[model samples]
Structures are given as C-alpha cells and as structure tokens.
Target: MILIGRTPYATCQTAANVKALRTKLFTTDGYEPRVRPIDDQSLPIAITVDLYLLAINDLSEVSETLKTTAFLGLEWEDAFLRWTPASYNKTEYAFWPQVEMVGGSKGIIMDYYEANSGWDIIDSSWSVDTETGDSTINFSIRLRRKPLYFMLSVIFPIIALAILNLCAFLLPNECGERAGYAITVFLAFAVFLTIVSSSLPQNSESVSLVAIFLIIQTTCSTLITILVLALLRLGSFDEKDEKVAVPRVLTFLMRKLKWKSRSKCSKVETEKDGKMHDSQSSLPDASESKVSRIEMPTQLHENRLFKEASTVDEFSWKEVVVFLDVVLFVIFAIILTTSLLGCLVGAQRNAVN
Candidate 1:
C-alpha cells in the first residue's frame, strides 16, 4: 500500500486520507493454461481507499504554527505472518512521489497562510517485532501558520483603543469628559477582549501572545479611568467653601509649577501694617489717633473684602488638575507606545522564527 495525500482538520485534531493505493498478489495453483495472449494475462490490481484519521494538534504556537501529525499503521501477529522490506529488494516500503496536502483548501483562512513547512512525510518507518510479529508504519505531517488576520482584526484594534484611552487625558478635566472618554475606551477594550476570547480555543494550555497584549491594554485602560476619577476628586472643591484646604503635597507641586497664591499672604501683611500704623498713631495726639483708628478700621474692612475677592480668583485647584492631566498623559503615552512597539517587534520575531 502507498500513502499518497491527506487533508487535516485543525480544530478537530483529525484528517481525511486523500489517497491510498493497496496492492494484492495472487498465485496460480498447479494447473496451467494451454496458451494465453499477453493482452489476456491477468495484471496486478490496485485499489484506492479514503478513511478518516486521528491526528495530534499542537497549538503551543497558535499565532505561528498549527502543527498536526497523522499516523498510518497495520497490526500483525508473529504466529500468523511477518512483514519486512520487499523480499526481492533491500529497501523498505517506499512512499509515493509526494503526499499532497489537499486539505489546505478546507482549512480556515483568517488572514494566515499555510507556512513553508507544508506537508512533509517527516517520520516514515516500519517497525517490526520478531517475538510478536507486531509491525507498524508511521508518518507525520507538520503545518505551520502565518498569522495576519489576527493582528489586524484583534491586536490592532486593542492597541488603538489603548491609545485612545491615553488620549482621554488631553481633554480638559473641567469639561467633565475625561472620565467619560476613559470609561468608553475601557468598554471598547472589554468588547475586543471578549471577541478574542470567544474566538480562541478554550482549553489552551498557555495564553496567546495576542491575548496577553489585550490584557495589558485593558489594564492600562482601567488605570487611565481610575486616574481620571482621581483627578476629578482632587479638583472637587466648592467655590463657596472658604475652609477647603488643599493638601500640602499638592500645594508643593503647585509651587513647583509656579502656581503661587500670594493674595492671602499679601492681605495678611497689609493688615499687620495697618495695625502697626494705628498703634504708632496712638502714641501721638489722642484726637488725631482716635480719628485715624476709626478711619483705619474702615480701610482694613475694605481691604478684607478685596482680599476675599482676590483669594477666590487665585486659590482654585484648576492648575493642579491641569498639571496632573499633563503629567499623567505623558506617562501613559510613554507606557502605551513602548508596549505597542514591543508587541510588534515580538510578533515579527516569532514569525521569523
């Protein structure tokens, strides 16, 4: 018998035998015919058979390779019969000229191509046991995958959503859209992740690289959303609340950013100077001092009103929010860019290998 071709079913770990030919030999008893023309002589017979075969599927490199192995064998008993290489020749059973992979046409086409490995009769051998007369022929076919559809459909979209999440920081926090944008991008990432998860095999032993990348993207999106919320909280202060104190750390950061609130300090200094002037005037004429003190109280009261107005204008947390937004945006952009570049480079390297 000769093994000629096969079609592999990747998802099912099975294949359909494309072509096989069996040979049969017959012997004539003692009787002989009187005469026979060459055209009338019996010839060797050949028959073709197709059968379903179980195969081993290796998905370790799902993104790179879809390796499958099919086996063909016959069992023999020592007491009954023993098989060997051709009795007249030294060589073992020979393979057909080629084992065509006719099944490639039936395989899934998700932007990946059948890699160069193709159909190879990698391990062809006939093993025989003298004691038991057990015999077997085994051959394997290896298929490699080249992934393009997955990158385009799954990976690229996830990366784009991640980038969009990073860009949410560019929206001004006062507009109240930064958090919304981050949440929307996070939801988009979740949708992509669900799509990818549903497409991949459920019982894979290891995570796909694309899945890992999507997970990282989702994490970044979630963190960006949290950051937006935190910024909103940091900037949440009632304009009517006079006693809302800014944190010392935030105050320090504002100073570093050159956002100084000098109106309150200046107001305090002016009040101190007015007190000193009134005290000094009291050391002089009583009537003039009393008149000066009365006028001084009115001036101090007017100064307090002016100081309150200036304080309201100068003490807002808007600068802190803007600085936080800008800083976080830069950090997130760097992280996202590095992650995307690394993933691309890694994928290319895996494909090459």
Candidate 2:
C-alpha cells in the first residue's frame, strides 16, 4: 500500500517471484529433488559439468599421487521450477539455496600433508546463473610444488656420493686411511638409500630406475671396499719375498695399458786393467768396482712410484697396485656416469609413456 504523503517504490515483484517458486517446488504437488527432471520415463538426465583448475596443492612421487584445487561447476534443468518472466515481472529469475551441500568434496579431495600446514579450506562460494530455465552453479576454489626439487635433492646428491665412492681408490694404500675412507663412504650411501625408501610407498608395483641405479652403485661400493683391502695387502708384501709374486695376467695388463715414464739413463761401463767394471747405478762407474747386474722389467716407474732402499728397476708389486687402482677407478667412473644418465633418461621416458 502507498502512503498518502509519500511516493511508493516497487519492491513486491522479486519477493512475489521467490514466494511462487518455493511454493510450487517445495509443496506436495511439486517434484522431489531425487526425481529426474525429464518428462519421459526412459530418458536420461542431461547435466553439464565443468571443472576449472585453479591450482595444484602438492605432488608425491613416492605415492604417485597429485593434489589439486579447482572449481566444480554443475548445470542442469529443473522442469518443475520453470516460470514465465511476465508472471514474476522480471527479465530473469534465480533462487539461492539456503543450506550448503556440506562436506560434498570430502572423499573427492586429495589432502596435502605438512607438519604445520592445515588441510582445512580457507573459503569457498557458489552463485546461481540462469537463462534457459536451467540452473547453473558458478563455483570457485583456492590452491602451491617443484618437479626439479627431487632431481636436485635426491638424484644430484646420489651422483656426487657415487663420484666420491670412486675417488676412495685414489688414496694411497700405505697411508692406512684408505680402508676407513671407503667404509665411511659406503655407510653414507646405505643411509641415503634408507632415507629415500622410507619416503616412498611400500606397495609400489613398479621399480624405479633411480632405485636400481642406487642398488648398482651400492654393490660397486661394496666391491671397491674389498678390492681396496686386497690392494693394500698386496702393497704391504715384502719386496724380497719370492713366495709372493704378481700374477701373470696382471703383468700382461700392465704392459698393455702402461702409461710409461721412459728411463733416460744410458748404459755405461769402464774397463780397468782389462777387467770390465759394471755400472751399479744409472751414472757411469768412476771407480773400477765390480757389482751385481740388475734385470729390468719392460715397465718403468717414475719418482711418483714407491720409495724403497733397493734400486727398483723392475715392475714391483706397488706399481701393479697403482696400475690396478687407476684401471678400476676409470672403469667404475664410466659405469657410474653411464648408469646415472641412463637412469634419468629411462625415468623420463617412463613418465612420458
């Protein structure tokens, strides 16, 4: 009703429309929510669903799971709720639902785990839009992971540790620290593997290339430890002992892969009173003193070789140990490098597939 002294503004139109929709839809004569909106009994309900991904919350390589946040928009027709615009005196008509669809996304959502981070949603909202007697919900949601983090923290560090394991062979065996050094490196690798396995899901059916790579590396480290001890023992043997001798195959390998330091001293001798004075040292014999001759091996070693009282003209056990150390280092380094690269490449291929 309009007051006699005041002008009336029309506000009853929207209120009337809402009241009509509620009564028509909610009354006993109206349709139920569970009932299909279609007129035909055999026909299927056509509902339009759209998901707009807003963010990615987390990623777990171990579990092979990804967590994300998005807008789950749903649109459908409610034939019973339709009304004529002229009857409501409005261009468009919409009714907002009073109570929310509480806990709708509980089982559907993947929760990210962090010690201090909460799994609770900050906020969420929805709005209704209609044009062709259809109800559309415009939903909105809010979302944070780096793919390279694993490569840097896990893969790169493993490569570095493998390289360090190979370097243990470079330490001199006589120093008495090589054994301890190799053992420590192996222990560190074992610890790293343990930590990595703990984070991964135990029920995983597929084996990771990275995991295989680490196992191979661990085996190599163990073998290296044994070899180091053997080499140390070989190095400590008495030079004069004829009982312990270098193997013939090792001698052959040394000649084949010899990084030679050629001897510069030439053979010289002096004759005194028709008696030949053999040169004991590399220098020419000034005094006519007779000395025992020394037989030299094919391989010559430099001052970097082991220091001994006797003139070590021939290839000694120490030289063999040094040669083997270099050979093993080269072999393992190549193996580790190749395997690491292959592991990463294979893993990437699997991911793509």
Candidate 3:
C-alpha cells in the first residue's frame, strides 16, 4: 500500500469479518503477475486483467444502480494502474476499491479489507455481502497509440517540401528567374525545417525525413544556381560577330542539326549588288571584259550560304523547343534517379533489418 492519491473507500465489509479478513490476507497471500509472451509481429501487445469494483448493497430485496466507491487499490503493476484510465458512466475514475490481492487456487483474488472510515449505512441500505464471495471486475487492456506526434512531425514536412520543389519546372527561363526562384524555395524549406525541429525532441537517431528533404532541396538549389550562372554567360549568340564556343557535348550534337540561315546585312548587300549588275549589263556600250569583272563580285556575294548566314537574327521555334525539351528531360532524369536511389536504399536496409 502506497497511496496513489487521496480518495476514501466506501466498503461493504462488516466490522468483524473485515478485521479477520485483513489478518488472513496480508499475512498469507502471495501471487505474482507476468506478461503473455507473443511472437507475432503484427499483433499489438495484449493484456488481460481482472478488476474488482467494491460496492455496498442493503439486505432489502430492491437493488439500486451501480454507484462509484471512491477508494481504489491497484494490486498488480503500479505503472499500469497509474497510466490506464478506469471510466464509468459519464465520468472517468481510478481503480481505488477497498480490496487487496490474495493468492487463490488458480491465481490472485480480491479480498475484503477493513471497514472504510465513513458513515454507517441504514439497516434497509445494503452493504455489499463480502462474506460469501469476492466481488470483482475484469477487463482486457492494450495501447491505442504509439507516440504518433513524433512520427508525423518528421513525415509531413518532407512531403510538403518535395512538392514545393516541383514549382521550379513551371518558372520561365528568361528574366533571370531560376536562380532567385531556387534561393526562395530553398529558404522556405529551411524555415519549415526550423519549425519541424522545434517540435521534435533531440535524440540519437538516423537523419529524420524533414532533414533529408531540406538537404535535398539545398542541393537542388545549388545546382540550379550553377545552371543559371552558366546560362547567363551563354548569352545571346546571335548578337556578337565573334564565334560562340558551344559546349563540347552540344557542339558534337549540334553539328548534325545546324542549318543555313540568311542574315540582314548579307541580304541587303546581295540586293544592292544584284541591282548594280543588272544596271552594268544593261549599259549600251558595255565591254565583255568589264561585264565579267562586275558579274564576279556580285555572284560571289549572292551565294546561298553567304546570304543565309547574314539574314537570320533569331532561332527558329522548333530549335528553341527542342533545346528546352532536352534540358528539361535531363533535369527530370536527375530527380528521378535520386528518388529511386533513396527508395532502393530504404528497401535494402529494411530487408537487412
């Protein structure tokens, strides 16, 4: 008897019987409790317990409804009694009946203890007849939850941050948007991680899901930052007279895709030279020698390759689309590969465990 809390018992034991019962109970009784070992992984922990709710009833034939007796005693594991709730009617209560554990033929039995320190009941009022048999309540116990908050706090943020990262694909490439967008999303993930860490307890464990998400997001942001800088340096190739050095990989691929295009300067020069040749050939006293000289210069500049190179100021829509499609596919490949690797690692570890 350790007193869990201050709640008095309303016992039904008679004076003489209660005194004798206590002497017999505390001196003779010895029973021990143990767990029911279960090997199945799917099954949750199961507990079977016999509980007694002590009550008093008058000798009169008419019986009343069940009433709460304040005194509660827990004879088994003290830890279980303190944690489990014993709810009845509309209100919840603790098991504080006026009883004690005594060894029986099969297992433990509840015995009537001393008279509760309370007012005596009327003659018509029933005091529960404890002299004949033990009055007990039985129940089966199990846990409902296993620290769900700890698990959810780790899982939800990771999923949320991963979805947020997908926003990068929708952002337009021009206007120097990709770098800023990556930085903003990265910072947002950092803020979410800060909130997640505040909720979780500090403990020794593998990296949590939220931490993994933040790290991945940061890595993506760094990669995007590098790509944005590279693209900025690539610039508008059409604007400069100097030959743009394409990437070795792209140059190899582009050699097969390159096509002729006419620039404005070459087209203007060609039209002017054509008019001069026509005027020269139309001259009434035109010498054949002078005609050949005039025709050679115009013919050289009028060729398809020379004129096409000078006139094209912009890339065709089809080429632009193809370039973008390839770049986006590469990005998608990286994300898919990383996700598959994570899944593979998780699965392998699970199998090993």
Candidate 4:
C-alpha cells in the first residue's frame, strides 16, 4: 500500500523521539521558542513537522573561513554547519527552527522546492539512520552589522589618535612652539572624541573603547596643560634666580670665536697707529720716547679692558631669549614624555584585554 502524502511510516515515527533526544543533547532544558513552517510544493511528499526548536553552535572560529553555502558541503559532517545569507527580512529579530529527520535508510539528497504559500525551501539536505534513530538541525539569525560597527567606530580611531601623540617628541622647544602644538593636538583628539560619543549608544557599556580613549586623552591634555603652566612660571621668575643663559659649552665656544675676531681688529688698528707715530717721530725728538712709551701702554690697556667689558656684559635681550627658550624646551619635554607613556600604557592595556 503506497500512501501518497505524509504517510505514517513506522521508521519515521521516531522523528519526535529524535527531536527530543537531540534537543536535550544540545541545550539545557526549559527553553521556549517560536515555530515557523517551511514547506515545498514541488515535492510529491509532504513533511509534517512533529517537533521543532532552535539550535545554536559556537561558530566564531569557523565563521571567517566559511564564505558560502558551497563550503558547507565540504564540512557537512561536522557539528557546525555553514550558512550563506542571501537576504534577511525581519524587523524584529528571531531564531531559526531546528529540524529532525528519521526513517530513510538511504543517504538523504539536497532538495529545493516551492510551496503553495509562494515561499520556497531554497536548499536543504537530510539524513536518517536506524542506529542514530534521529538527528537535529539547529539555526539562528543575528544582527551582524552592529558588532562590526563597534569594532570600527570605537577601536580603530582611538588607536590612531594615540599614535598622533608620539609626534610631539620630534618638535624642538626654542621656537616658543610647545604651547600651540600641544593645544592643537589636544583639540584634534577632542574632536575625534566628540564624533565617537555621537556614534555610541546611550545604553552601551561604560567599558567601551571610546570611554577608555576619552579618559586617556583628557588626562593627557590636562597633564600637558600643567606642564605648560609650570614652564611659564619658571620663565617668569627673576633672571638672577633662573640661571638664564645658554649652556656653558656653547658660551665658551662663542666667546673664543669673538675673541679671535676682536684680537685681529685690535692688532690692525694698533699697527696703523704705531706706523703714524713712527713716521711723525722720524726727526728723533727728545720727548717722543717718553710720550710713546707711557701713552701707548696706557691706551692699549684701556682699549683691551673696554673690549673685555663689552664681551662680558649680559644684555637683557640675550637673557630674555635664553630664558624663554629654556622654558619652552622644558615644557615640550614634559608634555612629550607624559603623552608617550600614556599612549604606551593604553596600548598595552588594550592588548592584554
């Protein structure tokens, strides 16, 4: 007797038992789920589902490699099955139904069919065994785009901003440039933070990457501000207390170079004066020796003392410039060091987590 549609086969009667056994095996008890019917009109045989439930397997390790439905065929026998999404249509999220098969001794074939409701089973496969008695297929639908955005908006931008902080070390402080540079970099990070905050969900977790970066950058900015303030205070102090001058080595070299120039000039002037006096005294006057001997030494000593005084006297402009440059360098060095260390710690913490 050949029964046409949904004939109750004795072997197939075990579908309910198989569904229960597989459900218990895969999930803990007491799970409630929605049910949706999948039907095919092309097949002469009709599938009457006695039991259906949702099944979820961890696919994080394999999801990257499984590109299409074709890949599922290669690893079909494994505990996990690959799925390629053609389209997903549901305003509200839902889970997929777990299906169980039984009764067929021969291997199951992949099937595609259209049903009366205009819906089609695009692709499916089934296998049954008397020893196994039943088998279950579990499925789930997810909103994937949200998690991807989390990685992009929060994680990558924070890292890039942190990298920018490293550039401060390359700048020199003598240009009175540290204050402006630090402020600009701080504002840039602040703008990035504003964009990040706008993108985040209000109810999102506090431990998010944006939150971490905001805290880090804010701290860095504050520290740099403090350094700038400190340097400015040092710069404002009395020159006597500040020890305001270029380094001793540079001063020494500068003095030596100037000394050589001045010595050469003095020698030329003295030679011209001596030549004039000699030519004037060519008649061998009696008092000439006395005047020449006494006045020449006195004038030479006076001129030398004048030159030395000029060389040694500290000008206000020179002190002011040196003081400002020292202050700026100190400020820049502090800011650069603090920012770099903060970035490093932030990176290491992120990596560890």
Q: Which candidate is the best by lDDT?
A: 2
User: In order, how many clashes per candidate?
Assistant: 0, 0, 23, 1
Model 1 TM-score, all chains together: 0.51
lDDT of 1 at 73: 50
TM-score of each: 0.51, 0.48, 0.39, 0.29
lDDT of candidate 3 at residue 253, scale 0 to 100: 48
lDDT of 3: 0.48
Q: Is candidate 2 or candidate 4 better by lDDT?
A: 2
Per-residue alpha-carbon lDDT of candidate 2 for residues 251-275, written as tens digits (9 for 90 to 100): 6676687644222121111122112
Pairs clashing in candidate 2?
none
- Candidate achieving the largest TM-score: 1
Clashing pairs in 4: 41-114
lDDT (C-alpha, whole model) for all candidates:
0.60, 0.65, 0.48, 0.47
Give the number of colliding residue pairs in candidate 2: 0
Rank the candidate models, highest TM-score first.
1, 2, 3, 4
lDDT of 3 by residue, 129-175 (tens): 22334443232222222335634765555555555555564455555
What TM-score does model 2 achieve against the real structure?
0.48
